[model samples]
Target chain A: MSTAYGVAAVVLVVLASALIGGFGIRLSRTTSDFYVASRTVSPLWNASAIGGEYLSAASFLGVAGLILVHGADMLWLPVGWTGGYLVLLVLVSAPLRRSGAYTLPDFAEARLESMLVRRTAGVLVVLIGWLYLMPQFQSAGLVLRAITGAPEGVGGLLVAAVVAVNVLSGGMRSITFVQAFQYWLKLTALAVPLVFLLLAWRADGTPGPGAGAATWALPLAGGREYGLYSTYSLILATFLGTMGLPHVLVRFYTNPDGRAARRTTLAVLALLGAFYLMPAVYGTLGRIYLPGLRGGDMVVLTLPARLVGGVAGDLLTALVTAGAFAAFLSTSSGLTVSVAGVIGQDILRGGVRSFQAAAVVAVVVPLGLASLTRPLPVADVVGLAFAVAASSFCPLLVLGIWWRRLTSAGATAGLLTGGGLACGAVLLTLVGGPHTGLAGALLAQPAAWSVPVAFVVMIVVSLLTPGRIPPGVARIMVRLHTPETLDLDRGDWRPRSS
Target chain B: MATRHDDASVYERIEADDRFRELRRRFRSWVFPMTAAFLAWYLLYVALSGWARDLMAVKVLGNVNVALVLGLLQFVSTFLIAWAYSRYAARRLDPLAGEIRAEAEHEAERERA
Candidate 1:
C-alpha cells in the first residue's frame, strides 16, 4: 500500500474536522450552546454524534485485534460495548437527562447536595477521562505508524493538537456535527471494504480460521488463570461503566428532554449495533487469512493489503486509516471537552476562556502519558478505564439516582474507596510486572470485586448516617424521576444560561 | 418569589402526592425488571463463554457456531429491548410522570402567587 493515500486520508479527516469546528464556533455564541448545544439536538443527530464518539479506537481497531488474537471469546468485547448502551438506555438516560445536570459533578452536587461529593466526582471524572484518552492517543500513534511508517509519537501529537483545537474552538455544540459526520465516515470506511473482503474470501474457497486448536473455536479457550472470573468481571465493567463515562453522560444532556434522551440512547444502540457487526467480520477474516499477524490491533489495517493487493488494497487501507483517525479525533475531542469542562468549572475560571485553556491541558497531559508509556493493546487500556468507572461513578450514579437515603458523606466515602481501589489496581497492572496469579487476575479485572464493594459500602454508610441525608433530597428526586413536559418546580436553574 | 419556605413546601407536597408515588411505582416496575433481566442475560453469555464452552461451540448452521449465533443475538436482543422500552415508556411511564410533574408545578405556582 502506498503511503500517499494513507497520509492524504489522515490530512483530509483532520481538515474536515477543523472546518466543522469552525462552523460550530459561529453556532456557539452562547454559554448554553457551549455546555449543552442549547439543549436542542434532535434524537437522530445526537444518536449519530454519540455513535461517532463512542465508537472509539477500541471499537474500530481494538475489537478486531482482540478477536484476531483471542478467538470467539473476544466477541464479548463488542457485545459488551454495544450492550452497555442498552443498560444505559434502560437505567440512566431518562432520569439523568431529567436531572438537568450539565456534567457528572453537577449531577453529584445536585443529588447528594454536597460540595465534597461534587468535588470528588470532578476528580474522578478527570482521572477516568485521562485514562480513557491516553489509549486514543496511543492508538492514534499506532495507526499512523502502521499506515505511514512515521514515528509513533507523531500520531499521538498530531491527534492531540487537532482535538485540542476542535474542543477549544467549538466545545460540545461544534463537536456534535463533527462526531455525527464521523460516525457515517467510519461506517463506510469499515463496511465498504468488508464487502470486497468477503467476496475475496468466498473466491478463496471459504477457508476457516486455519484449524485453530478446537479451543480457539470455543469460548474461554485461553486457559488463563481465573478465566471465568475475568470474563464476569469484564462483563460487569463494560455493562455498568457506560453510564459513568463523563463524555457519554455529557452527550445525554444535549437532548431536549428526558424523552429525547431516551430516544437518542435507543438510536445509539441501533447505530452501535450495526457498526459493531463489521469489526467482527474483519476479525474473523483476519484470523482465516492472516494467521501469523502479530499485534492483533493492526488486523483491520493490514488485512486489506494482504487480500486485495495493489491500488485497490491501498485505497481501502487509506479509507480504513481515515476512519481510524476520525475515531481518535471524535473520541478524543469528546473526552477532552468533558475533562476540560470539569477542570475549568471546578479548578480554573468558569467561562469559555477557561474551558479553552483546560482543553489544551486535558489533551497535553494524555499526549505526554501516551508517549511515555509502553503501548498496551488499545482495548485492554480502555477496559481498565471501564473498570475504574464501574467501580466509582457507577455506584455514585446508581445509588444517587435511585436511593433516597444516600448522603453526601456516604457518596464521598464510596467514591474514594471504589475509585481509589480501582485506580490502584490499574496502576499496579501498568507498573507492576505482568500479574501471574490470583492477585494478577484481581488487579487486571477489578470491577467484579470493586463494584460490589462500592455498593455495599455506600448502602451501609448511608444507612448508618441516616441524619445526614440532604433536606433537598425529595426535591432532587422529583426533578430526576419526572418527565420534562411537567410544569413542576424542578428548579428553573439552567446553570449560567446565556 | 422563590423562597426557602416555598421550595420546602413544594417538596413536601410532592413527597405526599399520590401521583408521585404511582409514577414511581409504574416506572420502577418496568425499569427494574428490564434491568435485572438484561443483566442476567449478559451474565449468562459471559458464564457460558467461560464455564459452558461446549454449549457455545455447538454448530448452529454452515460454518456458524452457537457462539456466532448467540453473539449476533446479543445485538438483536439489545435492539429488541431498546425498542420495547421506547414503546413502554411512551405508552405507560411518560404520561404518568408528566401528569405528576404538571400537578406539582401547578401547586408550586399557586403557592408562589
Candidate 2:
C-alpha cells in the first residue's frame, strides 16, 4: 500500500544482512572458515540457517498464491517439500556430512575417484543453482513491483547486488548467520499478520471458502486434466529432489559431525513444519476475503491490506514485504555460496579470492537470466529445479554413499542422462509453452519417470563397468559410515589443491 | 601402489569384521525400513488425495476434511520419525559404531607403531 514502509523494510533488511555478514567475516580468518565455517556450527543455528535458506520466494509467496488459485491440491507442494527433508534426514544427511566434502563435486571425486564424475557434478551444481536462483530474482522483481512500483529489472538488480556483497564479504560463515536471522524474521513476519487476519475473520463471522465451490476445497476434484499423474509426479520430485539441491547439500558440510547433522535436520523439520502452517492460512483467507483478486502470488502481500485496511494493515504489509525480501536474499546468498564454492575449487584456484570472484559470477548469470526469460509462477520453476535435482544428484548421492560397486562411468552416465532429460523437459515447458494431453502432463512433471530411469541406468551401468570401481571403495565406505568421533585415520579429504 | 594396496586391505579387513557387519546391519535395518515406511505412508496420503477425493472431502471436524487431516498427519509422522530415528541412533547405531571405530583405530595404530 505505502511505498515508504515497503522501501524502508527493504532498506532495513539489506542493512541488517550486510551488518551480520560483515561481523561474520571478522570472525572468519581461515580458508576452512570461509568454506564450511570450520565445521563448527551447532545444530540449532545450522537448522535455523537451513530453514532460512530453504524457505525461498517460492515457499514464502508462491505457495499461498497457488493455494489461493488451486485450493486443496496445492497443499501437496508444501507437504512434499517438508517430506523431502525427511527423506534427506533418513538417507542423505549424516553420511553426506561424514563424507567430509566441501561441495557435491568434492563428494563425487572422493567417492568415485573420477575427475569426469567430479566435473559432471560441478556442471550440474551450477545448472541447478542457476535454475533455482532465477526464480528468487524474478520474484524479487515481482514483490518489489507489487510494493514500490519499481521497474522489474531494478528489484532483481538490487537483490543481486545485496546477495553478492553479502557472499563476497563473509562467505559461508557470515552467510550462515545472515540466513539464521532471516528464518526467525520470516516466521514473525508471517505469523504476526496471521493473528490479526484470523481475528478479523472471526469478527466477520468466520465464513468458509465461499458456498458450494466443492471442488475448491477438495484435492483432485478440480477438473484439470491428468490431476492424479501430476500430483504423483510432484510428490516424487520434491520428496527426492531436496537432497540434490546445491545449497541444501552444502549446509550439511557445515555441521560439526554426523550426529550434529542429524540433529540439525530434525530441527529443520520442526522449523519448516511451523513456518509452512502460515502460508495455507494466508491462502485460505484470501479466498474468503479477497475473492476477486488476481495474480495469486500477490495474495500474501495483498491480503493484509485488503482484509485489515488502515495504518495497521500497511504496517503488516510492510512486514510481509520485508520477509519476502529476506526470502530472496537468504536463498540467493546460499545458492551463490554453493555455486561459488564449486566454481572456485573446480575451475579457478581453490581459495577465498576465487570464491569471491565466483560469487559475483554466480549472482550475475542468474540476474541476467531473470531479465531475459519471462517469469513463470515462482513455485513451478522451483519444482522444475527440484525435478532436475531428483533425477541427477539424488541417485548419485544415494548410490555413492551406500552402493560400493558404483563405478565412475556409471555415475557419469547417470548424471548426464538424468540431469539432461530433466533439464530438457524443464526447458520445453518454459520455452515451448503449455501443451495438452498425456505428453504435456508428462513434460510438465518429469520426476515420476526421470528418477526411476536415472536409478536404473546408474545401477546397470555400474554393474557393466564393475572393473572401474575405485580401489579405495572400502576405505571411503568406512569413512562415510563411521562416526566422526572415532579415532580412525579417515583420509584427509580437503578441497582439492587448496 | 603398494601403499594403496595396504590401505585397501586394512579397510577391507575392518569391513569384514563381525562387529562392522553388525553395525552395518543395524543401520540398514533401521533406516531402510523406516525410509520405506514413511515414503509408503506419504504416498498413500498423496494417492488418497488424488483418487479418493470423495473420501478426502469427508469432514472430520468443522471445515477440516480428510485431506487436511492427512496432510497434517504427514507433518506429524515426519517429526515422529525424526525423533524416533534420533533415539534409535543414540541407543543402537551410535554406540556400536563408536566401538567399531575405536577398535579399527586401535588396530591401525598397532599396525603403524
The window of 10 residues in a row where model 2 chain A has the poorest summed lDDT is A483-492
Global CA lDDT of candidate 2, please?
0.88
Error of 2 at A460 (Å): 2.3
For all candidates in order, the CA lDDT equals 0.86, 0.88
Q: List the residue pairs that clash in candidate 2.
A: none
Q: DockQ of candidate 2?
A: 0.55
Residues A134-220, candidate 1: write the lDDT tens digits. Answer: 999999988898888899999999999999888878889999999999999999999989988998888989877767636665777
At residue A108, candidate 1 shows an lDDT of 91
- Tens-digit lDDT string for candidate 2 (A385-485): 99999999999999999899999999999999999999999999877756678998898899999999999999999999989999978778887876656
Q: Which ten residues in a row have the lowest lDDT in candidate 1 chain A?
A: A489-498
> By summed lDDT, which 10 consecutive residues of candidate 2 chain B come out lowest?
B1-10
